[model samples]
Each structure stands twice: as C-alpha cells, then as structure tokens.
Target chain A: MSFLEVRDLSVRLKGGGPLLRNVSLTVAAGEVRGLVGESGAGKSMIGKAILGILPRSVEISSGAIVLDGTDLLTLPPAMRRQRVGATCALIPQDPLTALNPSRRIGPQITDRLVDILGWKRAEAEARARALLHEVQIADPDRVLRQYPHELSGGMRQRILIASAFAAEPRLIVADEPTTALDVTVQKQILKLIAGLQARHGTALLFVTHDLGVVSKVCQSLSVLYSGKVVEDTDVARFFAGPAHPYSAALLAATPKYTDPTAGLNPVPEAVIAAVRAEVENG
Target chain B: MTLVRTLLLRLMTTAVTLFGVAVIVFFVIRVVPGNPVAMMLPPGATAEDVARLTALYGLDKSIPQQFVIWGAGVLHGDFGTSITLRQPVLALVLGRLPATLELSVLALVMAVLMGGAAALTGTRLRETRVEGGIDVANGMALSVPDFLWGLVLILVFGVLLPVFQISGRVTPSLHLPFVTNFYLVESLVRLRFDLTRDLLAHMFLPAFALAIPLAAIIGQLLKQSLKETMHLDYVTLARTQGYSEARVIWREALPNAILPTLTLVGVQFTFLIGGTVIIERLFSYEGLGNMAIDAVINRDLPLIQGIVILFAVIFTGVNLVVDLTYAALNPRLRHG
Candidate 1:
C-alpha cells in the first residue's frame, strides 16, 4: 500500500453541485504527485479533503483516506490534527492569508517550529533565521522580526514556505504555492520546494492548474475534469502521449512559443463544439 | 501608522468641533436676557434694592467682561457661588464629581461585561437558528433610551421589590484600586467578603443603566467585527494548520478583531460621561452628569462653562489614548 492512499474519495457541498466525485489517488514515500485541472475542477478540493480542511458545508460523502496505513477518515478530529501538523503540512495559495497578520514573522515561523516540531525556542529561532536565509529572503533577521504586512508579497510567500518547512512533515501538500508570486519569484519558490523535497525525501501533493509547473516537479499527474479524474498516469508517459481526449485538448490549448507568429492554439473546434452541445442539451 | 494619523486627525476635528460647541453654548446661555438681579429679588423689593443687587453681582457689567470674569473664575477653580445651592460652584461640582465618577466607572464595567457577553453570544449564535431572537433583543436594548431604562429599572427594583434602593450614596462602598481612598483604607483595615457584595450592589442600577447603551453599542460593534474577522484568510489558514476551532477563534480571530473594539471602548469613555446626565438625575445618583444638570437648571453660568470645557478636554484626551492603543494592539497599524 502507498504511504498515503485515498480510495474512491467523493466530496459534495451543501447547495452546490458535487465538488469531487469518486476521485482516487495515491502517494508513495518520497514521491511527488501533481493534481492538475482547470479552475473549478476540484483540484484544490482534493488537497483540502486529504487534510480534513473542507469548508463547513462540504461533506466527504464517501472515502477512505489512509495516512501511513491508518485510516485518516476513522481517526477523530484532534488525532487527525496531530497527524496533520506532525506528519503533513500545507502551504496555502496566498502567503498573507496563510500567516497571522498581527504576529511578527519570526515568532510566527519559530513558534510553529517549537510547538509542532518540538524544537526549543533558541533552536527554533535559529532554524527560522536559517530557513529564511535558505529561502533567499534578504536581511533574514529583520524580515523575521517584521510583521507579514511589512514584507513584500514575494517575501511573505518565502516566509510562509519557510514556516511550512519548519514542521519537517513527512508529506507536504502545496496548494498553488507559487500562484501569488511574480514570474521570477515563482520559479525560485518552485526550485526551493524541489530542493527541499529532494533533501528530506518528502512526498508532495503539488496542486496547481499550471501544467508547466506540474511538469517540473511531479513524477505522476492526475487530470481532473468536472469533479472526476479523467486521466491519471506517470507524468513522463502522460506528457509524452496523452491518451484521454480532454488531456489531448488541454495539451493542444497550451500556446507553442516555437510559432510566435501563430495565434495561440485554441482547444480543437471539435472539443468546443461537443461542450456546446452538452450545455445546449441542459 | 497611517491609520493612527487618520484617527488622530478625526479626534482633533472632534475636539475643535466640541470647542466650538462649548463656545456657542456659552454665548447662548447669556442671551436669555433675564437679569440675575431681577430673578433673585423679592417681588416687593424696591428699585433701589434691585439696582444695588445688580451692581453687587456684576450684572451691570458688559457681556464680554462678564464672560472674561467667568473664564477667569473657571481658570482659578472658582465657578462663582451657586444661587440655589448657596455654595461655591467649585465646591458643589467637586462634591458631586466623585459620586458621578463612581457611577460612570461602575456603568462602564457593567456595559463592557454586558456588551461583551452579548457580542460573544451573538457571534456564537450566528450559525444557530436562534440568531434572529438574539438580534432582536440587541436591537431592542439599543433602541430604548438610557433614562427610560433607568425608569423601568426603578419600577422593577425600587418601586416593586423595595429590596434595593433606586438611588442614594454609593452604599457600603468597597475599596476600588486607585480611585476611592475610603474603601481602600477600610478594606486594608479589615478584609471582608460582605464589603465586596455591598459595593457591587451599590454599583448595580446606575452601572446597569449606563451599561445598556455601552453594551448595546459594544455588542453590535464586536459582533460585526468578529464576523468579519472570522472570514479573514488567516483564520482559514489557522484551521488548515491543524489548530482546533476554538484556538482558531481565540488566538487568531479574536486578537485581530479586538483592535477596533479597543479603540471604540476608549471613545465610549467620553460618551459615557456625557450620557450619564439623564441616568444620574433619574436615579438621583450624584455624579458629574448630575452636577452639569444642576448647573444648567440653576443658571450657574461659570459652573456650566467649566463642566463643559472639562468634559471636552477629557473626551479629546481619551481619544488620544485610544489612538495610542491602536498602535499597540494591531501590528499592521504600527509597523507601517
């Protein structure tokens, strides 16, 4: 069995349509997986479900999520939380949203290290400084002491990544970690994640809509469409020759830089024509 | 820091406007035209007696000179002699000042507790079906005037039960820190549980009355701000970080939401002092509000001017203190 195995996971929100339906995937130890989909395709929902961080109205209708061979669905909330912090950590999309705005960045990062990672205050502080430096943040000490608001968007994102790494969890689920950063910073953050994952041999569930990023970090990829996984395959094979029709259409949609003069390749006229038919039927 | 600057500018505007209000009130009182000489004289008194009295009281002096004399008296801590009380205005104001201070302080405590409890309950009840009922109660409490509440309280606690007195000296006062020397002295001489209850009882009605408006205002403010804070991204992040729901609310949401409430509390301090007039009169609780009332009714010009100016200064001072607190509690307001 994989280290973390999700079997037939389904999620539905009250008053909203099904967010995820019978989506199943697995992550082995030291493996990085990419869950890719268009917007509103339940990619983030899958990340949230694994962590038991769903919104109040959403329910996991049917699923068995086993972490380290223990069913995550069977454990109580408190136990689940303990496992989450100590075994897994989440890096949310926006750094500002992820960090407490009122707390100084250093204490915010170090406190998590001490509390969840069981590092002493001094050790945590030192680690926090080093982590900030590791993330390429300038004036690590000053940035650590400053509030999240005082730092630029990219700086805050780096600080968040440092805090996530402070936990040293077995698995890290990064939900659009690089979305809020600029192009330059995004690449840097991704490289940092890749380096960290390699150093620690940590499994990662990298959730994003950007296929280029998925191609960079992931060994396996799951393509979701309308609350279901349309394709799940090894990243190399899938990218080499996508078998699913939707996957083919998505790949075709990515603009080719080789032909700059050509208008961006639109999804094939046949695929669009089929979607229009489905909508018209309802 | 910019938020602090914005708050300071608003406070300064409030202070300047309050000064203008004080000046206008000063002039308007004098414009009422009946001479103190005519008002004080016996109906059968001869014209000579009236003329002599007018000169003695400086009623014959020009309005600006009278104002100057009144202002000087204010600066010198002499608000002239009260015609009705047959005492110096300063003495009367001071005598009643302590009582009003006690009432206002008690009311502030009560209001904070009441409003805080209501806000906490309302915040919790938001997801429950009973939220509408609690909202209605808050609205009702907010809509009713303070004096009317005092009257209702008197009827229930005073007129009916007759168990607790509706109004009088703060009964069986227990020592309060830094405020009442007598209570502190007594408490130090002998520590007793009975004294505490007596003090709490004495503070009950007026405090409850004063607290109604404050609590209503605070509860509404807290509930709205807390609701907004709950929606903030950090709260969601805290939950996702494997923190418990209670910890998320207390550690993350409460601290972030409380800054505005603290600022409002500081500003409310001044409003409480101002609002206590009707409360003091209704319960006959001696306080600054009561003193202001006596000054107005007795046409004690110097006393009225002094009380108004004092309140204006205190209000502005309280606002400045609140602004400083904002910088302390909210890092976003400070680090910038």
Candidate 2:
C-alpha cells in the first residue's frame, strides 16, 4: 500500500496562476521514488507539498495530499502539521543554510522529537547521537555541542541528515539534499541517505534533477515538466527507454561519463516547445 | 588575545574617544563668537572688568594654553568651575548624570518592549493587511521627530487627560528616601511602590515620548530582518520538522533575525542618549541635557565641554556593551 499519495494536487500563486498543475505521485512504505525534473518543474514543490512547507507566495488550490490514510489538505492547520510532523521529515538542499547558525546542532536535531513528539530530552539526545552515527558522522557527542558554522559543509549535511531521521518518520523527503555539497561529498551523502532509507525501511520521496542519482538510489521514478507529471514508471525500464520525448531529451542532455569524447547534448528546443504546449493546453 | 585583552583594548579606544571629544568641544565652543566672561559680566561693565573676569577664569590665556590647563585639571578629576553656576563642573555634571541615565534607561526598556511586540506582530501576520498597517505606523513614527512626539504626548496625556505627571522627575513636595538619583531603581529595590509609582508617573510621558519613534525604528528593521530570515533554508527545514509556526518563528528564526536588530538598537541607543538634550528641556526634567541647554545659552564653556564629554563616554560605553552582547549572541564570535 502507498504510505503517501498526492492526487490531482494543484498549487497556485495566490490569486495569480497555477504553480503545480494536477500533479499526482505516491511512495509506498520502504520504497524510494525519485522525482525527476529540470529547474521550475515542480519537483521540489511536490516534496514541499507533502511536507506542507510551500512558500507563502503560493497556496494549495485543489486536490488531496493523503498521508497514510488521511487527506492532509482537508485537515485543519495544527492537526495537519501534527500529522506531517509525526510521519514526514525533509532533508533540505543547501546544508550550510539548512542548519540554524545561532543554534547548537544537538537542539536543532532533537527539537522535533522533544517539542512535537513530547519525547524526553535525554531520550531525544540519545536518538540524535545514534542517528548521527547512522548518518556516518563521527564524534556525535562533540558535534552536538558545536554550532553549524563550526562544522564543514559535509559535516553540516550529515548533521541535517541525522536531524531528518531523528524522529524516524515514515516518509522522508530528500529535496536535492546533495545539491550544495562538494562533488566528493555528494556521493558519500547519497550513499548515506540510501543506506539509511534501506535500514529504517522508510518511504522516500527523493526530489532531484540528476538522473544518475536516481539510477543509483531510486526504485521508481516520476518525470516532471512545468508542474505536470509527464511520466511515472519503475526506474529500470524508464532508464532503459523513457516513454516521453522530453524525458528522452532530458536523459540525452545529461553528460555521459561512459563516452567522455561525446559532447553534451542540450535538451532540444523543439521538444521543450511541444512539452510546454501540451502542459499549457491541459 | 583573551577577552581581558580585548576589553583593555576597547577601554583604551574609549579613553582616546573621550579625549578627542573633550578637545573638540572645548575649542569649538570658544570659537563660537561668544565670550564666556562677557556673558558673565553685568551690563555697562568696562573692558577692564571683562578682562579681569577673563583672566581670573584663565580664559585670557592662549586658546591652546587654556586647553592644556583644562586637560590637566581633567586628569586630576577637576573639570574646572562652571562660569554660570560658580560651582565645580564635574560635581554639577555628575549630579545631573543619573537623572539622564534613569530616564534614558527607562525609555530604552519601553522601546525594546514596544518594538519587540510590534516586530513579532508584524512578522506573525506578514504579507497581510495588519503587517501593512504596522509598516505604515512605523513610517509615521519615524517621520516625526522625538520633540514633536514629546509635545504630542504632553498635549494628549498631560493636558487633555491630566492623569500623569508631565514635567519634572518626581513629586518634589514629598520627602524622598532615595540615597541615589536613580530613584526608579532605588525605590524598587527598597520596596517603595509609592515612590516608584510617583516617579514612573513623572517619567512615563517623557520616556514614552522618547520610546515611540525609537520603538518604530526597531520594529521596522526587525520586521524586515524577520521576513528575510523566514525565507532562509534553515527556517524551511525547521518547518519540515513539523514544528508549529510559532516555534519555528520564535525558536529558529528569531535568534538569527535578532542579531542585526540588536546591533542597530545598540547604535541607536547612543543617539537616543544624545536625543535627551531636547527631550529633557521640553519636559522641564532636571537632567544633564537640560543643564546642557542652560550652559549653551550662557556659553559656560566648561559645563558645555563637561556635558559633551559625558555624552561621548555614554555613547562609546554603550557601543562597547553592544559589541560584547553581539559576541554573546553569535556563537561564531564566542568560540572564535
């Protein structure tokens, strides 16, 4: 059964225009699904919708965000937050800025547990320490006392990963979590997230632009374009042959390391025009 | 270097600043085309009488020579005698210092409370009509100067309602039990509610008049900072963690947002203290600022110089405290 389902969900700029157009996707428990798209494709918006942290400039205009058995859009604000908090967490992009600079790492991680879940301080600290270890951070005890600026980018990302998993939420939204890290650190972080997702048996809504990352970690994939889901399929067959022309172009556009002599193939303007027309027409 | 070293460095800088203020104020007031001795002289007095008075006060000496003599007296804790008051400038300035401090500190506290409330309200209700109203209100407060605010406050609270003590520091007729001029603090410490109430009643209008525009300034800066902080990635991460909007704002966003606002408050405080000149005179309160206006009218060079030096000291002193506070709030500085 799907642990979280977004059905015909539409988000619009307040009294303006649609930001997300009838978008829908799902993640079953223990399944890792990559949300693939270019910039402004509403990939991260889906993750934000699930987590209910969309910017104030936009509002969820229609449809249902069903987490477990409940439709979150129908619930009151407080109840919805409580439900989301109990079941979902986000591994945000930009690790440096994702940790509060003024606060210590320990409280930033333990806060969700202690404040929201009413977990005892000691219990939350213990969980945080263990989660840090799970995320491959060393000297968890020392790290907890340190400020965000005191740590490196990789270390900060690890701390953020640890924070996201502190509550052991059923669903984790990785919103381009490795985008701001060094190239070397990116692989390690990706590996750590994939391992943690497997070990915890958590449903993962992994949002990213990199198809290579999806090839490594995701079981299923959703290809997005202009707030619409162009294609949704299992990762293996989708990689083997993307059903949509835009998806094929996106794949082709990604530089292949296997053939370094082959130059980068930019996504064709013809393909983009057709996709834009199709999405706008709908 | 250690904190001690840093503190010693700041103190040295402070001393240099005070010395600069002393030199500048003493020389500038002399060059203002007014003779202190002439101001002191009775009408129809001869040039010989004026010359005698000038020589007696050491004002007849060369300007630079007079500065050296005054600087020496300052080193020995003698700020020279006030020509107008015929008393030690140090004693007179010191006598008025606490009254100014008490008023300034009370006004500062009020501003912080009012500004904090305004900022929190605006931030909580951002992009709404209420936030827009607060911004407009803040602009209104900022556009009007403190003296205008003082007059408006007096007209509304003092004359119209007739509820508060509009002028003076306390009920002068009552036998005061205060050992210090810090009546507000001393009375509260002594559990003297009646004295405290009476003092606050007198201080309330003046302090609030000073506070309104200051509070508005702080509110606008802090609200803008808070709005920016709310958009940062950490704040978004905080929201994703399932924390309530209040917790995300108060706990996560506020700490980061308050840093810049705190610095502004610190710098604004120096200006706030300087602002007491017009405020104190308008209120008829006995403060250094009120004394400063009197000295300037009489061209009492020593008294004016003394007041200016004291103002400089307070400004630099507040800036030092702010730097230390900024360090405490920012962990990066604290650990580094």
Candidate 3:
C-alpha cells in the first residue's frame, strides 16, 4: 500500500461552494510527488484535508485520507489526530508567519515531540538541537534560544523544515515551503528538503506553483487546476512531453533557462476554458 | 539596559506630563467664576472678610504666582490646606487614594476573568450560535456606562434581593485589626475570611458595575484578536502538530491575541479610575472619587488640585506598568 493515499476526497465550504472536488492521489514510501497548480487551484487544500487542518470555513464532505494503511476518516477526531501526528507533518508556506514570533525557536520546534509524542523536555530539546545541526544551521544553541523575529526568513524556513523532520514523520506535506524565501535562499531550502527526504526515506507531497521546482526535485507530478487534478504523470513522461493540453500550457508558462525568450507565455485561454468546462461537467 | 533607559525616560516624561496637568488645572480652576473663599464664608460674611480669607489662602495673587507658590508647596510635599475641610490637602488625598486603588484592582481582576472567559468561549465556538450570543452579550455590556451599571446593580443586588453590602467598604460593626488602608489585602493576609467576605459583599456590586463595560471591551477586542490570530500560519502549523483545537488556541493563538487587549485595558483602566467618582457617589463609597466631587462642589481649590495631580500620577504609573508588561509579554521587545 502507498504510504499516503487520499482517495476520492471532496471538501466544500460550510454553506458555500466546493473547495476540493473529488481529489485523489498517492505517494509511495521514499518518493516525492509534486502537486503543482496556480494560486486558487486548491493544491494546499488537499494537503490541509489529509492532515485534518482544514480551516473552520470549510468541511470535508466526502474523503478518505489513508495514511500508513489506516483510513483517518473512519477514526474518531482524537484518534485521527494521534494517527496523523505520529506519522505525518507539514512544512508550511510562509516561514516568517509560521513560527510564532512571541515564542523562542527551541520550544516551537520541540513542542510537537513533547506535547503530541509525550517525549521528555530534555529528549525533545536534544533532538531539536540535533535536527537543527542536520539542517546545516550554525550555532544551534544560540539559534535555539533566539526568537523567530531574530532569525532571517531563510533561517526560519530551515528551522521549520528541521522541525518537520525532527519526529521522523513518515509523510510530510510541503505546502509551497520555499515560496516565501528569496530566490537564492529558495534553492538552498529546496536542496535541503530534497536531501533530508532522501536520507530519511520519507514520502513527500510537495505542493508548489513552480513546475521548474517540480522538474528539479519531484519524481512524479500532478497538475491541479480549480480544485481538480487535471494531469498525473511521472517526471520523465511529464517533462519529455505532457499528454494534457492544460499541462502543456502550464509547462509553456514556466520560464525556462534554455529558452528565455519563450518564458512568459500566459497559459492559453482556450486550454483553461476547456479544462474548466471539463471540471464543471463532472 | 534598554528597559532601565525606557523607565528613566518614562519617568522624565511623567514629570513633564504632571507639570502640564498642574499648570492646566491651576489656571483653569481660577478661570471658573466661583471663589473658594466666597464659598467658604457664611451668608452674613462681609466683602472685607472674603478679601482677608482670599489673601490668607494666597488666592489674591496672580494665577501663575499662585501656581508657583502651590507648585513649591507641592515640591515640599504640601498641597496647602483645604479651604472647606480645614486639613492638609495632601493628607486628605493620600488618605482616600488606597480605597480607590483597592476597588480599581478588584474591578480589573473581575474584568480580565469575565472578559477572558467570554473571549475564549467566543473564539472556541466561532461560526456557531454561541459565538454570536457572546458577541451580543459583549455589545450589551459595553453600551451601558459603569455608573449606570452601578445603579442597576444597586437596584438588583441592593434594593431588591439585598444580598450584598451596597454602600460601604466593610461592615461598620465588625471589630477589625486594620493595620493598613488596603482592607482587602490586609484581611486576606490576616486570614480574616469573615472580614474579607464582608468587604467583598460591599465591594462586589461596585466592582462588578465597573468591570461590566471593561469586560465587554476586553471580550470584544480579545475575541477579535483571537480570530485574527487563528488565521495566522503559526496557529495552522500548531494544529498540524496533532494537538487538540483547544490546545492550539490557548498555546499558539492566545499569547498573540492578548497583546492588543492588554493595550486597550491599560488605556481603559485610567478611564476606569477617573470613572470612579460618579460610581463612588452612586454607592456612597468612601473613595477619592467622592472626595473629588466634594472638592469640586465646595470649590476647594487646593484639594481639587491635589486630587487631580494624584490622579495624574496614577495615570502615568499605570501607563508605565503597561509598557513594562507589553515588553515582558512580547519576546521581541524583551530580547531586543
């Protein structure tokens, strides 16, 4: 069985429209699956629903988030939390806002282990220090004592990544983790995440708008648009050529280093309309 | 080092602020058509007698000269003597200050507890009917002023049920070992639960009246803050840690949420202190507010000046404490 399988999931606002439309995806152990889409494509919602952190505004209408052979939807809320917490974690979008500014870095990273895992404070702290070291953070002791505001954006993201990996979680949903960093810092963070995933052999559901990032790190790619998965293909198959016209338009839209002049092509209106109609039809 | 500098700077600003309040009060009071000397004299008193009394109290001098003399006296820890009471103005104000302080403290505690509970309840039950109910309650509580609430409380707790002492700080008949003016603190320290209960019986109505609006303000602001903080990324991250919603709200969201509320409460508290005058009068409570009213009615210039200055000192002191507290609660401020 896949390490993480989201089967026929659907989510909608409490009294409003749908946010995710019958989404389904899987990530086998030690694999990276890039969920790529535009801003409002509900790429993040899939991750949120799987992790049971959907906002109060939205509710999962029908979904089964099967993590490590257990269907989370079938479990009670407390048990679902326990199951998810034990096996899965998230690396969020904005590093600056993701670490509570009022808190010290040490406690923010160590809290999951202490609170959810019921580890001793000493053990958690030691683990946090080692995790920080593994993330290539210099002077882990001083960094631990510092507040989020004291660290740079890159530094905060690194801490978050380290925190996500600290518990040895089997699956981590990287929700556009590098989107908030500088272009230079983004490469370093991406490399670090990919390196850690390889070393830990954890399944990763990488959510991003950057197809270039997918080509670099993802083994497989799923192109999502307007709360629906439009295309799902392996990295080689996806890059060598895409079968879906929407996927082709999306790849064309991403600026390439080899063909800089062809870079800024807006995804064709025809393709978006056709795909949007297809989504509405079902 | 920054904190010391901040306090020293705050103290300097406070001195300047008090001087400004003194100047305004001295000149403004003199501008008012009434003369304390005329007010003091009986109906049969002659003009010569008024002049003599005015000169005796140094009210015959120019307003600035009078201020300099009063200011010098104040610098020497003397606020002259009250024209109406025939006592040192400084002594009277100090004597009445602690009662107001104790009442204000009780009101603040009550506000925080009641308001915090309402805010937490509203935040926890957001998008639900309960949250809407809390919002409505907060609005109702805030719309009415404290003195009006005092009257309502008196009507309910005093006149109708008559369960609490609605007029005084403690029972008149209770033989009390009163070492300090802080009856509440002293009673608790002495383990005088009976005395404490009696004092609370008297204090409860007035304190609750004062707290109701402040509680509403706190509830509204804190709940709004909590809602905003709930949408913040850190809170979402906290939830993804597999902690319960309550745990996330309390630990992750509340600290940030409480900051704005603290600022509002700090500013509102000074207004609360100033508000005590009408409240004290409504309840016939022995506080500085009651004295302030009497001082104003009698045109007791020296006493009024003294009371206003004391009020100014308390205001500045509360602001200082608030700033220090903000620093302590916020890690950026503490470490920076």
Candidate 4:
C-alpha cells in the first residue's frame, strides 16, 4: 500500500449534488504529489477531506482515505483527531489568516506539539526553536514572542511551515502554501517545503492552480477538471506531453515566460463541455 | 511601561471627560426653569426670605462663579447640601452609592455569565431548533425594557409565588451589622451567612430584572461576533490542528470575537446604571437612581448636579477600563 491513498473519494453538500466525484490519488513515502486545477475544480476539497476539515455543509459521501493502511473515514472521531496532527498536517494557504491573530507565535507553534505529541513544555519549546531554525528563520526567540500581525507575510508563512512540520508528521497537505506570497518569497517557501520534506522523508499532497509551481516542487501531478481527476501522471510527462485532452488544454492555456509573444490561450468551451460529459458518463 | 503609559493616557482622558460633563451638567441644571429657593421657602414666606435663601445657597452668584465654587468643592469631595433632604449631597449620594454599586455590579455579573453561556450555546447549536428557540427568547427579552421586567418579576415571583422579596435592598426590620461596603459584602466579611442569605433574597428580583435586557444585548452581540469569527481562517486552522470544537470556539474564536463585545458591554453597563432609576423606583430599592429622581422632583440643583457628575464619572471610568481591556485582549491594539 502507498503511504497515503484516497480511493473513490466523493464529497457532496448535505442535501445537494456532488462537489467532488470519485477522485482517487496516492502519494508514496517521501514523494510530493501535486493536485493542479482551476479555482472551482475541487482541488482544496480533496485536501480538506483528507484532513477531515470540510465545512459543516459538505460531507464525504463515499470514500476511504487510507493513511498508512488505516481507513481514516471509519475511525472514531477522537482517534481521527489524534491521527490528524500526529500523522497528517496541513500547511494552509493565506498565512495572514491561517494563524490566530490574537495568539503569540510561540504558543501557536508549540500547542500542537504538546497536544498531539504529548511533549512536555520544555521539550516542546526546544523543538519549536529548532523547527523555527529549520525553516530558516533567524532570531527564533524574537520571532516566537511576536504576534501574527507583527510579522511580514514571508515570516508568517515560514512560521506556519514550522508549525506544520513541528510534529514531524508523515504526510503534509500544503494547499497553495505559496500562492499568496510574492514570486521571490514563493520560490524560497517552495524550496523550504521541499527541503523539509526531503529531510523528514514526509509525503506531500501539494494543491495549487499555478502549473509553474507544480513543475518546480512536485514529483507527480494530478490534473483535475470539474470534480474529476482527468489525468494522473509523472511531472516530466505532464509537462512534455499530457495524456488527457483536458490536461492538454490546461497546458496550452499556461502563459510561458520564455515565449513572451506567445499570446495566452484560454481553454475553449468545447474542451470543458467534452470533459464534463466524459466525467458524467461513468 | 507601555501598559502604564496607556493607563496614564486613559486617566487623563477620563479627567477631561469628567470636566466636560461637569460643565454641561452645571449649565443644564441652571437653564431648567425652577427656583431651588422657592422650593425651599415656606408657602407664606416673603420676597426677603426667598432672597436670603438664594444667597445662603450661593444661587445669587453668576452661573460661572457658582460652577467654579461647586467645582472647587467637588475637587475636595464636597457636594454642598440637598435643599429638600437637609443633608450634604455628597453624604446622601455616598450613602446610596453602595446600594447602586451592589445592584449594578451584581446585575452586570449575572448578565455576562448568562449572556456568555447563552451565546456559546447558541453558536454551538446554530441552525438547530434550539438555536431558533433561543433567538426568539432573546428577541422577547430585548423587546421589553427593564422597568417592565421589574414589574413582571414583581407580579410573577413577588405577587404570585411570593417566594422572594419584591422591593428594597433588605427587609426594613432586618438591619444587619453594617460594614463599609454594601450589605452583601459586609455580611460576608462579618461571617454573617444568615444576613447574606437575607440580603441575597431581597436582591434577586431587582438584579434579575436589571439583567434581562442587558443580557439580551450582550448575548446577541456575542453570538453574531462568534459566528463571524468561526468562519475566519484561523478557526479552520485550529480544527485542522486537531483542536476540539469546544477549544476552537473558546480559545481560537472567542478572543477575537469578544473584542467587539467589550465596547458594547461597557455601553450596556452605563445603560444599566441609567436603568436603575426606573428599576429602583419600581422596587423601592434605595439606590442613586431613586435619589436622582427625588432630586429632580424637588428641583434640588446641587443634588441633581452631583448625581449627574457621578454618573458621568462612572460612565467614563467604565469606558476607560473597556478600552484598556480591548488593548489587552487584542495584540494589534495593544501597541497602537
């Protein structure tokens, strides 16, 4: 079995139509798998489902999110909570809002470490300092005492990364972790995440709309369209030549910085319609 | 040092606010068409007697001069004397001050505890029939004013059940050992649990009456703020971190949500003090509100001004505390 496998996962509003339909994907140990799609293509929903943090309105209708051969969907709630931060962590998007504004940076990072890992305060503080250093933050002590608003965006994202990795979980679901950051900070953050994953041998499910980001950090890519995974392939093949029609259209639509005069190609309505029909048929 | 600086600044602001209120109250009382001298004089008294009474009370001076004299005396903690009550205004106000303070404080405590619990429950049970029921009840409570609440309490608990005392701080015949503070505290300090019980029994109806409206206001504010805060990104982050629903609500959402409610709490407290007028009169509770009304009826200018100034001081002091609390609760506001 893979390190984390989501099989036939489906999510829908409590009394409404499906928001995610029969999506399946896997990330092997130490591998970084990217889930790339447009804004409403259910990319984040899959991540939320894995962490079991979907909004009250939405529920997983049919699915087994098996992490390390355990079906998380069937686990009791208390056990599920135990498994979430200890085995699986999420590096959320929008660092400004993701951390509690009223809390100091130190406690926000150390709370999960103490709560999930059952570490003593002294041990957690030591580990937190080390995590901050690992995330390349200088002056960890000063950063620890500061509130979220006191830090710059890059600093906040870095602190969030430290927090996500604090428990040394086996899998980290990074949902557009660098999307809100500037290009320079984005590259640094992506590199930091990759370096941390490599050092920890932690698997990652990286969700984003930016294909360039996927190319830089992801090893394999899953192309989603209208609540379905249209293509799941290695990163090299996805960039060199896509297998699915929707994937091909998505690749075509991406603006290449190397080819400045290559005008952006918007995905045609016909391609979207064809993909939707294919998804609905089976 | 910063906290101290912030406190000092707040104190300065409070001083300026009290001064402004004193000026307004002094002039406003003077402008009201009445003569304290006429009220004090007997029916058969001549013009000479009226003039002598006016000079005696310093009403013969210019308005600003009278204010300066009153203001100076106020700085020395002297509120002159009530013309009708035949006592120092300061002494009368202070005598009734503890009762008002006790009632107001108890009512405020009850409001916060009940409102906070109701809000927490409402948010947790949101979108359910229970929440809907709570919303209806809160609406009904808010619709009725505190005086009406007092009357209703008197009718139900006092007249019908007859379980609790309807009026007064304590039974007239039962005077316990009096210490400096209100009866409850004095009783507690003296280890007089019997008197404490009696005092509490007498206090229950009036305090509950004053609390219902304030509680409704606070609960509504808390519920709305908590709902909005629960939708914030940090709440989701807290959930993802495996914090339980209760923890997320109390730890993650509450600090942020409660900041807005602090201002409302302060304003509501001042409202409660103002509300004590009708509540005290209806219940025959000897509080500052009752005295202020009596002063108004008798056209007691010194007494009226003293009570207004005291209310303004309490109002300003409450606002200052609220501002400091806001700074303490929210780190963003702390430094700025």
Structure candidate 2, residue pairs in collision: none
TM-score of 4: 0.95
Tens digits of per-residue lDDT for model 4 on A88-167?
Answer: 88898999899899999999989877876789988899988999999999999999999999999999999999988888
- Report lDDT (Cα) of residue B310, candidate 2: 86
Candidate 2 local Cα displacement, residue A117, angstroms = 0.8
**On a 0 to 1 DockQ scale, where is model 1?**
0.59
Name the candidate, 1 or 4, with the larger DockQ value: 4
Best by DockQ: 2
lDDT of 1 by residue, B1-336 (tens): 576577779878986777586667778878975455566677999989988877776767887788778767766767677665667866666666666666777788788888887777777667675656667777988898777888888899887877666775446353444344344234445665466456555557777877887888888888788878877767766666677766677777777888888888988878788878888788776677877887777676667766776677667767777877788788765765
Candidate 4: tens digits of C-alpha lDDT, residues B41-79: 779999889888889999999999999999999999998
Give candidate 3's error at residue A65 in angstroms: 1.4
Q: Which ten residues in a row have the lowest lDDT in candidate 4 chain A?
A: A109-118
> Any residue pairs clashing in model 1, and if so which?
A106-A144, B100-B287
Each model's C-alpha lDDT? 0.77, 0.90, 0.92, 0.90
TM-score of decoy 1: 0.90
| Candidate 3 clash pair list | none
i-RMS, each model, one decimal = 1.7, 0.8, 0.8, 1.1
DockQ per model, Cα: 0.59, 0.81, 0.79, 0.72
**Candidate 2 CAPRI assessment class:** high
| Docking quality category of candidate 3 according to DockQ thresholds | medium
Ranking of all predicted structures according to DockQ, beginning with the best and ending with the worst: 2, 3, 4, 1
Q: Which candidate is the best by lDDT?
A: 3
Candidate 3 wrongly placed segments (more than 4 Å): A261-266
